[model samples]
Target: MVMKTKLLLIAIILFSTSSFISNRPVTVFMIGDSTMANRSIQNKNNKERGWGMMLAGCLTDRVIVDNHAASGRSTKSFINEKRWERVLDRIQPGDYVFIQFGHNDEKEDPKLHTEPGTTFDDNLRKFVAETRSKGGIPVLFNSMVRRKFYCNENGLYTDSLIDTHGDYLLSPKRIAEEKGVVFIDMNKITHDLVKQMGPEKSKELFMWVGKRKDDTHLNIKGARIVASLAIEEVGKKIPALGKEIRRYDYVVATDGSGEFFTLEEALEMIPLKGKCTVLVRSGQYGPKPPFVNKKIKITEEKGVSWGSSAAHAEKPLKNLDLYLCVGQSNMAGRGKLSPEVMDTLRNVYLLNAEDKFEPAVNPLNRYSTIGKGLGWQQLGPAYGFAKEMATKKHPIGLIVNARGGSSIRSWVKNARQSGGYYNEAVRRTKEAMKYGTLKAIIWHQGEADCHHSEAYREKITQLMTDLRNDLGIPDLPVVVGQIAQWNWTRKPHIPEGTKPFNDMIKEIPAFLPHSACVSSEGLTPLKDETDPHFDAASQIILGRRYAKEVKKLIKK
Candidate 1:
């Protein structure tokens, strides 16, 4: 009681702005060999193990990494043991499953060895199919390289970090490309990481204590570093799971003065069904710790925000209606905040530009002067769109990833490598799905690309198809918003930019199943020629239109 009182006193003096997250933690199902598995302590010399042991520590508390990897189990043996069934049985929607197995498969044991592109590919397909069947995303990885440096008794190191696993790496790469699933080249990533450590220093990473040089298994330090690299890959290629890494803290407050304080407070007033973040300014409040249970997570930043109330807490994401908001400035949200819009918002949530889930309020996009004057007033269509669905069976959430002035060409997956705008958007979408079902992808582009009206339809269709393929959503519904017609376009400023683009949008539903486009025909522009985005009032109707179209698809 004394210790508890001390903690409560700290909570009051150093005010805590608690945010109760509504979703379940994101679970990472890890299936791999000894390189990525946990091992039992055999004896005093049992310091050797897999990197999976250190994965959870590398990740935030929200990510639950369930490592089912074993010492000698390959993909073939893992299935033979019926372990794959156990993993699939509990697999649910919005879960991430990782597979890595090659070391034992490379050995002479016929029971475990799998031919790179044949049996290996076959086994991988089963994992992918099963995971997708349960609506869970499957990720593949190659086993880490052994720390076998080609050296003699002269201690002359040469050709370090050799790829002994042979076609094992090739097999996973082929499967990933063939199936369009996310694949992490653990062998390549860790090999490069280990090579940087050098041969002598690299020994510290392997199971080489004093004299025992078992280069296969990694020690605590090696495992931790290797695990860190593997996780880093998780965020790199499979961005959806990457955003949930929780590498740092997000401060929330009672007063709307922090990065996410406003969104958090808005949800607090309502019976928020999922998690949102916030930070409050200093004020006179009771000196008592929140009656926290297993669901709550309390954390403190460097105490930089106003007052000692710079507390942050969030769990892994789950169980919400996740949407993807992508496109140009209008989609970036130029709509200003209104009282009606704010008041009507309920369990609406958004995955912010920062990849954090907060209450979906106005300006669900971004503003240049963030944490500055009038910045908090930024509003957008996501709030109203999500709110319209709040009364439905599920809670509402949006992954907002839009820019002010980007062309359609920039959204192509190949083009995303250099600028990374499209990749970031995909990453945010994946993060949002960590907690919720991805119900729809909302796009409001074309003003910038409207000039290329001839290629507009094909570009739109191709991008949508590739996006679905990569995301493993074969028939995910797409809701596109048509660009507003400006007087300049009518007066021939750029005739191709307006009517042609709008015409293409009208035909989207005809070509794609479960797809629809919302019109801005009756909607008026912001009226500021210098800024031709939708006005605050018009955004409400636009959002509702989007909701109606998505709802129709849901009903169907």
Candidate 2:
């Protein structure tokens, strides 16, 4: 019984030790030439960077990237200088060694140059054998492409990207196949990337900073892109290493180059309560697709920007026109959302409370952060106006932020005395601008402030001025819809200040540079013309009229 107890304790200790060893992080040792070397940010002018420098950012914390590549070092020089020896000494069980060398091997220098079939192939086999002997997995990578644009018969630079690596690219692949190790074709990968970018745009990928233009070396942007390409392959060829790679929620490219071709496909990947960012390439897309209850932020890649900045690129999508719809309850739409109006417009989008773009439907203002909740929301003018302005080619985005009974003074910039919501409106609008261009501001409030015309003109003028200044649009178009001209709860008496408020709206374009007003004349109110809100039919007409006024202002 004593011997059995001792044996059981020994077994438990061995199992715990194995578990700790397995859970430890895996190290990835990168050995290559200058193209894969870590470079110093010498000055503002120095732009040369290596692909290995950006590799760690693409991976999770479980992978430790130890890059030992140096500038102007070949397979021959690396082994001779004991750099490979240093890396080999650190190789533990279950680690990875990424080998890439060819750029400097093709050089004519005595110390750097190695014949592709003989010395180059031999050095690669040596690295693979030594890495495996240490129980470390070896993955080989061919050198990246040099951005050399070949000239056509017309003597003009064509879009074709010519390869300059020659036979040096084959040595690594041949050794990988013989040694039964995973090989990543980084040369062909970057070649395809530069080719797709074309001749002129490809210059942004190489070391073409300031007055220096070296196609053989990579800049910061180019290096990150190359690293991503390598890892994309690593995720496929090396499954264990691939599991340690970071995953993105969405990747959209108009050219069908990213993970998902369309925005809808990417959005569908989001699970409930999932925090996601959509990485989009610069291009014109169709209408913004509708998503339900998911918070998604979109980022546009202005160019081939990779690494962390690539995930948060700020350039907005082209051809998507944004219109800010702000005011009181009338603009918020109290009318019933009919079955016909309930469906989403083809090319119209609603900026939701989470600052995401979805298909514009009835109760478009339901997502307003400062406005009343869904209990007070219904059909409004935004739907009809977006429907009128949108086309198959031109997408219209609506930002509806309005309180049911908000006074004009409540919208004054930093109006602390009135507990104003001007700051919230500006914050939402600025956030919405990341998705599209801000074309116009639609206003339809003033029922609350109708009783007094005291400094009303100056207040409204200051509001527009502050909004335009804050938005950085000196001549931003403003479309004001006249307040409802009906009695409340079927009372025969109309508000005395209603006419005066409408009159002020008429004189807006006279003083404002790009402002216009739509009349509320002949528009029927809800429930036997008793309610202050316009009925569904009248709301649609009001939206159409607002669209007409907006068109005229936009033309100017």
Candidate 2 lDDT tens digits, 1-556:
5566456434433432342268765667889888887765324346677888767656754566677888889999999998887577656667778899998889899999999899989999999899977767778889888888889888899877777888988988888766666778988898889999998898988888777888888876687677877898887765566676664444564333244545766677656575676666433345557666546777654322222212222322344699989998889887655335656566776776557676565568868776655435767888889889998777877888888778887889988545457877788888878877899999988877765655777888899889999988888899888877754423245445377667887888887778998999998875444356787788899999999999998887
TM-scores of all predicted structures: 0.44, 0.43
- Cα TM-score of candidate 2: 0.43
Which tens-of-lDDT digit does each residue in 1-556 have in candidate 1? 5566455434422211111032445557788888787654424236665787666545544555566777788889999988787577545455678888888777778778788878888999999889988767778888788887777679788756566878888888788767766678888887887788888788888878777878888876677567767787777655544655543222333222122233233233423444433232222122233433433343432212221111211322357777887777677665644334444245566565445555544456642211111222245677668777775457677777676557788787787433576677677677767777888888888877766777878878888988887777989999998888664354456644477778878889998667998988777665344345787677878888999998998888
Give the Å shift of residue 293 in candidate 1: 26
lDDT for model 1 comes to 0.65
